[model samples]
Target: MAIDERSVHGGAALVLRLLVCVVAARAVSAVADGPLLNGNFEDPPNQSQMSGSVVTGEHAVSYWKTSGHIEFICSGQKQGDMVLTVPDGSHALRLGSGASIQQQISLTKGLYYSLTFSASRTCSQNEMLNVTAAPVSGSPAQTGELPTQTVYTSSGWDSYSWAFRAEAGLMSITVTHNCGEEEDPACGPIVDAFAIKTLSQPEASQNNMLRNGDFEEGPYIPPDSQWGVLVPPVDEDDVSPLPGWNIMAYKKSVKYIDSAHFAVPRGARAVELVSGVETALLQEVYTTVEGSWYRLEFSAGDADGCASSYDDGSSSGMKVKAYAGTAETTVDVDFRDAGGSKRGKIEFRATASPTRVVFVSLGYHTKSDNSGTLCGPVVDDVSLVPIPQPYARRLLL
Candidate 1:
């Protein structure tokens, strides 16, 4: 061996130089990854569903995770956007088993951007890799570009992220992965983590916790409405019809295995407003406020979108519970429309009694999912106010 000219310069100076190089490299790497937002994952309120909001049943997912484990794939997606390339490639999450693909974060307003992930067509047909995104509010999303294209080794956690315009109310976000048509098996096309993030919450909203595992935080349908606080959804077998007395509207979220959630009087056709459609509770109410003009409002999003989409999605008469101590129960409607403003609504009336009612619930007309699955509306702002009574003779032909 020969003596090297680039030898240790009195040890200390050499160490200092090496440290400087390491620090520089780290700084550059950090800048390359861009800035990150500090935050915590949460759930919704008042019977709001959480079954599929986050996952980790397998493939390293989130199991009711708050921090550490990211909000990988919200909206009932288990395998998440992180999929196996086929011939055997996977990831490990600190919380769950499968890999995690975090939601596309929205830091500032009006900053458009793109996202990307990694995977290899290294193996054969058994593996498949694809990319997709959730349109923030559970709707159809647009397409963009990817950063580094190919993947076969542990290139570390490097994803493509840029600024974007949060045209939407900035209420929600989503994440999709590279896993589409299974071309073959050996193509071994799959990925573990599509994305990851660190989110930060505002100062005041902390008290307004959205997902404290209780479904209470909300910009809810009835923003001013409060839960029974004393009365909640009775057990599946608990035949507790929402207390009719001292009540205006009682909408509750029913949690079950999937959107196949239904109630007693099956085949009776429940109508309007249902969340976690894959499996949600049945909202049953007593109404018939005609003359006493009553407007029943119901809005549900991402409830039952999978196998159910309303093409001409219209809200019609509701199947309601008729009151007991009332006369001439069939409340008539002079005019009807779901406000045509919000994502959902409906109106009912009772030209006579003040307390008389008609029962109302959700029913599906077209179950073919003309609308996007998971595109259910969140019900809110249900109200009742007396509208001007029209002349009875003018109502009919």
Candidate 2:
């Protein structure tokens, strides 16, 4: 209700108001809670092991099993006495070449769950890790691929997570080190902060088509801002605050604007593709019904605290495109008039298993302040829902 009435006029205004109503009525299931035992590796109850110790089944952390060889790393220990900061806990897990750790959890068939953890390189070189989730109960077993990640932080750590649906009653999660082929085969990946939690059942239109669309999960928020612009290393295609969302900023600044400073139309955060002539944010959404019509609804406007605040005279705009292979929908927006926010939409039929959604800044506006920051389009509250009975619009009325 706290919208800028003047943002859109006449037919456009009416259409947006209806779209917002539809968005609010979408219903989604609730996620169950509780930490998967020793999720933070802060277990063993008051005991911290020194470096260079191997732990396996029965001797490893409670409810965890190991294969090949796994190392026990206590909190405050450096990575092999090197400069790299270790895990933030009383204990963590280390894997060498061919080493792996796994845990099994009881789950309901057809339920969705998310796995999150922290990983860091144990040496000066980069490292890669492979993670998997599969069912053990059903005959023939149902195994699914979870997201695998690489660690290259010279002196820090990074967190990664992914969501998966359970096809059987028991799910086994395994994390393996894939960096043993380097010069020092002993150097591998250090892991900590493990967690497994049930996610709400996904509902299209009622459910969010895009994962982490609100920019809520990602790197820590900086001291002064509500959000942070994620920039990738040179040659890397995607660097984003939210998982599954790729940010394409060729060195230009991007804004992870937060509600702490500006008016967020939906959640606590929004993203602004600032700086470059054409920076983009993109993601692929699964759970689509092939050949079914769907509606994509979202809000777009100018972000605050930048050179081109909404009230400022600078121009801000972007082009939003959604496609499943050949079928696509595109829309353009000019945020100069969007005060609180403006709602926009695109309708299309799914042609593939996953749909690609992209937002790219159309132009580069000059900096409004001393800082050389250009104001760009702000986007948030993106969602996709199936259009019920698209073919049966009217019964001979």
Candidate 3:
């Protein structure tokens, strides 16, 4: 029984090679957790890579690729008489007319991801940013044009969220300034605090027939931001920034607020209908039995201290109208109420298979402080449950 040394050596080498292959494969498939790299734009570019504030090279900004007229802006940097405002950090990137910046990210295919970023208009009133996520396979990209004309915060900076389903394992997220040539090449939007969050698919449970009823699962909000994230209007529910809900109205957006910034009714997050009737938050709950009676419960209130005055010296108060299929009800919460929020309910018979539930603000409101900031009723803790046939019949009788 002679043991061949060559055979033993060959086997040992094969095992070592297999181990190395496994380790390399794991490294290639591993995706980074948390936000994207250098998301805040705090990492400065080299002096050689920058001509004053304008980035000259393609990869001038750390962890990002730049093209055309891109500028690295600093907090308090003055452009003429106006000083720049950096919401997330001391530094941000500005995409001039036709300029763009992008970064390649590793993502899990088939998973839905929400990209949250802060942007502010620098010059033109109708400035727009084109955000896109392109896969490496050359498939159709997911793109959205977000308008910066409507500023939500007094700081002139508003955090926005957009969601898309990943088509491949590797994709590039790009933000491009859509404006044409202007008198000032530097006139554009300042973008900062880019973050990404993988959203969990919401489902109906026994406790709550609606998905994400508490509004706890949604886009990523910067911890230091005083203003909540704005969930931009989207026609489809699958691509909505807010999971399980869609912004059904055009030229309208709903504020996805956090308890840290505003008082939430029941959970850490809630939806504020800031644009009155223009803003509509809708969700289609499935598994609803037709002709079955269901009770919809929710909390409506004023985001305390959000606006200087809730009343405009008129009888029109802050109110929210909830619509369940064909039935609807309005809930009014006084601005002077001690409690920040009040619970409201609406009972209706399901008219469709997947009944549509919508919440809309009743009247247009602006802050009494003369800031002209939009304000409306805050909605939270939404729940829908089917009532027993006997109980429903008794109530009807």
Candidate 4:
């Protein structure tokens, strides 16, 4: 049978489409890498008939090695003289005095990664484990302490995680039981569910130097509701009552605004710095680079109830400010629109390791009769991003 020229071309096109689809599927699969080999300590068949015992030097668990007196647990194995349960699967690694299980993995330098693991107390008094990571070739090491807990869950374990920046092409991570010499050196801590994931780079617009900038974290207040009253000097020092923000009231506690009662420009919540007097909210930008220029963006407005009731001569506004050492910049926002219709921005070069960003309310009480109570300006959806040198110069000019 003679084939038409058009039919021949159609068959060729169909084959090409199928080939492209197969290639795209493989590419998508490569985006997510698997966990570390034997990360759960349950891999490799128990065909060797090796019972639960102390591990030292090289072993069958992929990408892992042992040091000191480490106990390799198997399915249904119980700790010595105690009824400590395994935290995961059928296997867990228990560390005795000075024992450690370590794994070294290759990673990209200057990239961010998150390491997470499950830990629980074991047969000893001081159930302490130190999980640490450092560059194999250069840079400093960081240690996270899961310290001194004598409590153990019957079935589950507490998971701990931390984020770090890679300083070199390879990083070494170790889980060490550091309870020191106790009555029984064999009784130490337990570890399981080890994992490491590379974090994606932050988008230029979403690169916020402050944590919980939108006031979404910390205490949960329903949207459009109030977080009650937060008194002044609340959670002083470096600690923050609102997660990343340290709130200070010049006269009284400020109100935490949620979208439940008002309009939220960014996230679920914002802050009302002044209900009756001036209030300040500050966050230290620890990720800022010295001498680098950064742009600050935020939304400012007033409570919906007071937005249309300025006829009594009561006025409300906000001041958004940033400071790095002695250098600082401030932007004044008028709450005339109410309910977060205005966006404010400012740019400054960082002079310190961590710059301080502050939001102050300039709300005033009414001279005449307007309503029962009045509130200050609202601040929400704050973000900071690094400005390139050329862009920074243009902005300054």
Candidate 5:
């Protein structure tokens, strides 16, 4: 059969058009999955939109809507005797009492997203930030409060993270200052950076029963941050910022440290129980076989970032207590040790379908430089594997 020249040329043109459409779709998806617009608050407002440092217009800040009293702060601006700090960029936003800033974000429905932002207390010791995510399609909102009373880093700034599941294609994120009526109207937290990351739900394999055991999959950490992100305690595991793990302590949080700032025994990240027994990390593995023998292996060590000496000379060591179902063990780490970390193991029998694993610090520790910053043992490289009955009998014999 003879092919017509016009038909052949037309077919080739159609194929080229299809490829262009596919490429365009991928580009749009990439932008949607990336960072938020003007998240670092580096985009300044015009002179008409500002009255001094306070924002006078509602939509003054680019890509955001403001309500009530909102101030645009510079990096080294002084407020009374204290100097304001903006670590993420040259500018930040200060939400006064009853003030809030919100932006509409594009997201994939039903997927979990972790929001990381750099915040610090600027005024009162009880300053707190209330963050909320509400769907545009009339779905329920997810809200959480971040307390900035405790300064984890010497820089007077710390990164905080929270997670929420998207319920619609478009969601609105709002950050408000939670202060009482009698307090000063200028008292609030300074917010410098905002970042969002989609979390991939991890699954267990034969080698490791716990998902995200290595602490590799979690919230986003700023590139310039030396102090680790703080994962606040959540009532439910489904909304946990740290994937597959729940902070089980009331009004406490675990410091998610990175290898760039602290010594990690394994992987690029780990968790530090900074609040002694007040902070607990808990995870439930659903793959556990009932009444089966299993071995729990983990690494517990000091980050070696603490102070060299305390007034009582008793804060030179760290200890972590681990619990697997009903069986438990304690691992002690001396700060003078060379590696700054050590490996530990525990063997236990599964009591139920979902086995509970928990880690908590036994004592309080502070930095050696007299900063009085809270520091504790680092937990990493956790794994749980089933042990054969025959092998268990031989070991016991």
Candidate 6:
């Protein structure tokens, strides 16, 4: 068959598209580093860091749970690009002139590269850490600098993001003192790590059903229990009181799911039904890998109830809904009094195994009655222990 000119061009274009696809796939795989950081340390904690010019604002230690911490240890440290991590009394971390950071991969030409990182300090102070993209080795034409600084206050964990473009190859990402004229020779802001990870081009249509953590709407792990992480409640941030227990309510009574460590992907299995008072339910979602064996253990307390009122302000009981990612899925757990057990047990079950979960939230049901706060199904403990994949043939209830 004789091919027409247009047909020939179309064929060529198709081939080009295929070639581009292959290249893109390869790049994705090369950069697709993940479960990200697992087991390097706490919840995978944070990477390594060094004591640069320490801030006298407060004595906080740089914890290194994992290795390869891209830390700015000292002032005038000529390791990567320029000197960084000098302290400004007013702010906690800032840049010194010529400060930069080297990365593993090369950036595109004239394409703006964005940077984002999470930082936290022991205390809440006026201190700020300046974030900047310093050019390490690249053409000046394409090295459009970004003007923004990341600050780590004496407060909680906060994030800062900025963008910059570069010539082909690599460039140094730096954090330095924002003020150019005045320099604090003795001050260097300690950088936890510099991130070069790029955001997805298009919003990823991820089945990310559940990756890890208790971000869902169930398996609430109460802190005051034995097996509970008690670090904080689900969706609770660092601002939450540390080293304490977060109560999971099921009965209007309070203190449900006490001392529970809701395994990643952990879900509620049962609810205690009572006749006297309103009840509460606690659930948690923990992260886990497929076939990983984990344990969820908890002991419910003597059931209790409370006053309930309707939208009219009448007293009664409320309804409940559970969610993960708040992304809304068919994923919701309902509390049932079907079981004859008075004290409900919140822990592991045999079926409905989850590989990954963001978080588990237990929301109460609001009906015409929204009076007394029901809290119970006391979860004494919870835990998730990863076992070999395929999980045990049967969940050991």
Per-residue alpha-carbon lDDT of candidate 1 for residues 1-397, written as tens digits (9 for 90 to 100): 8865557455768789899887544322121122212111222211222233333232222221122222232222234355322111222222222222343344343323222222333233322222333334654443322222222123222222211233442312333223233343112223322222222221212221111111222110111111111112233332121211111223232211111332211121122232222223222223334355443332222223223323474444322122322422222211122211122333344544334322322342222323321112222222333344563333332
Assess the local accuracy of residue 297 in candidate 6 as a C-alpha lDDT between 0 and 100. 29
What does candidate 6's lDDT look like per residue over 1-397, in tens digits?
A: 7769998899999999999887544322122211111101112212232344322211122211111212324334443464333221112233333332222334555544444343332222323444334344544432222222322122222333334445444454434333343343333234332334332222111322121212222222222222221121212331111112122322112221221322111243222221123322233333434333444322232223322334575433322222222222222222232111112222233233332222222333221123322222222223334433355545542
Q: Model 2 Cα displacement at 196 (Å)?
A: 2.1
Alpha-carbon lDDT of model 2: 0.57
lDDT of each: 0.27, 0.57, 0.83, 0.59, 0.83, 0.30
Question: How many angstroms is residue 301 displaced in model 5 relative to the true structure, after the best TM-score fit?
Answer: 1.7
Per-residue lDDT tens digits of candidate 3, residues 1-397? 9999999999999999999887544323233434567888888989999899999998767668889899899999998999998987699999898889988788999999899999998888767888999895678699987877888767788889999898988888889998855678777999999888888888889988998999999998888877788898886634877888988766668888889877788879998888878778999988899989999999999884433342454434678899999989989877652339888888988878889999998887665556666667899999999898889998677
Instruction: Quote the lDDT for 390 in model 1.
Output: 69
lDDT of candidate model 4 versus the reference: 0.59
In model 2, what is the error at residue 132, expressed in angstroms? 2.1
Estimate the TM-score of every prediction. Answer: 0.23, 0.53, 0.88, 0.46, 0.88, 0.26
**In model 1, how large is the Cα lDDT of residue 236?**
31
* Winner by TM-score between candidate 5 and candidate 4: 5
TM-score of candidate 4 versus the correct structure, residues matched by position: 0.46
Per-prediction RMSD in angstroms? 18.5, 19.6, 6.3, 16.6, 8.0, 20.4
How far residue 57's Cα lies from its native spot in candidate 2, in Å, is 5.4
Q: Local error of candidate 6 at 275, Å?
A: 45
lDDT (10s digit) by residue, model 5, range 297-355: 99988774653455676545778899999999999877663437778888987888788
What is candidate 2's TM-score against the reference? 0.53
